[model samples]
Target: MDFATPRRRRPAEAIVPMINVVFLLLIFFLMSAQITPPAPFDVTLPESENDNAARPADTLYMDAQGQLAFNTARGEAVYDAIAARAAPDTPLQIRADARLEAQALARFLPELAARGIAEIELLTGMP
Candidate 1:
């Protein structure tokens, strides 16, 4: 009887199910991520078709009672706090109620201007 060498068997291919699962998980996370807006106050900003630019770095708000509020803080002394917190170069966004008096706004604007605030934007409701 003649003796012959045994045939060598090739190893099986690696499983790809784990790779597919990882890819699916990545896609799920990407889709479920939340993108939040960068406003400190809950004021309903009036929208404009011409406003496709990014939001300003700082915000000031005047409520119905002619009271001023800054960012996330609530008080009448917000002007000084806002001036302290804002950068010298960043523009300030002002949101005032429709019924607010012009005299009150006039009184506070100069104070902001004196504090090295350059650009001031008045937010108005959409007509």
Candidate 2:
């Protein structure tokens, strides 16, 4: 009787190392990501045909009740904060609630101009 040679088995790939690498990548992305702060109040933006995407920089918020907020500043204090932060030429973005009056916005513009905000962009949502 001839002696049979023992069969050799190949080792399986190490899934544990792959899993560790994936976890490390997830951790890195979570740490490196920039998280945007929530808006101070809810705003229902007006619908428009415009498809423009707004930059997150230099934004002012106005609610349906005509209350204004800019960063940590609120109410009339927001004007002072905006004046301090805005340059004469840089356009400020206004995120106004849909329910806010056009007349109110008209009045608000002069206040901004008095504070030296010469230009502004009104943000709107797709209909």
Candidate number with greatest TM-score: 2
Model 2 C-alpha lDDT per residue in residues 12-72, reported as the tens digit of each score: 4456778889999999999999788789999999999979898767789999999999889
Report the Cα RMSD per candidate: 7.2, 4.2
What are the Cα lDDT values of the candidates?
Answer: 0.70, 0.89
TM-score of each: 0.57, 0.81
For every model shown, the clashing-pair count is 0, 0
Residue 5 C-alpha lDDT in model 2: 86
* Reference-based lDDT, residue 111, model 2: 93
lDDT of 1 by residue, 1-127 (tens): 7688886655433446677889999999999986545544445555555644657556677765667677666675676677688475677878876666779878878888777777888775554
Extract clashing residue pairs from model 1.
none
**Runs of candidate 1 exceeding 4 Å displacement:** 1-54
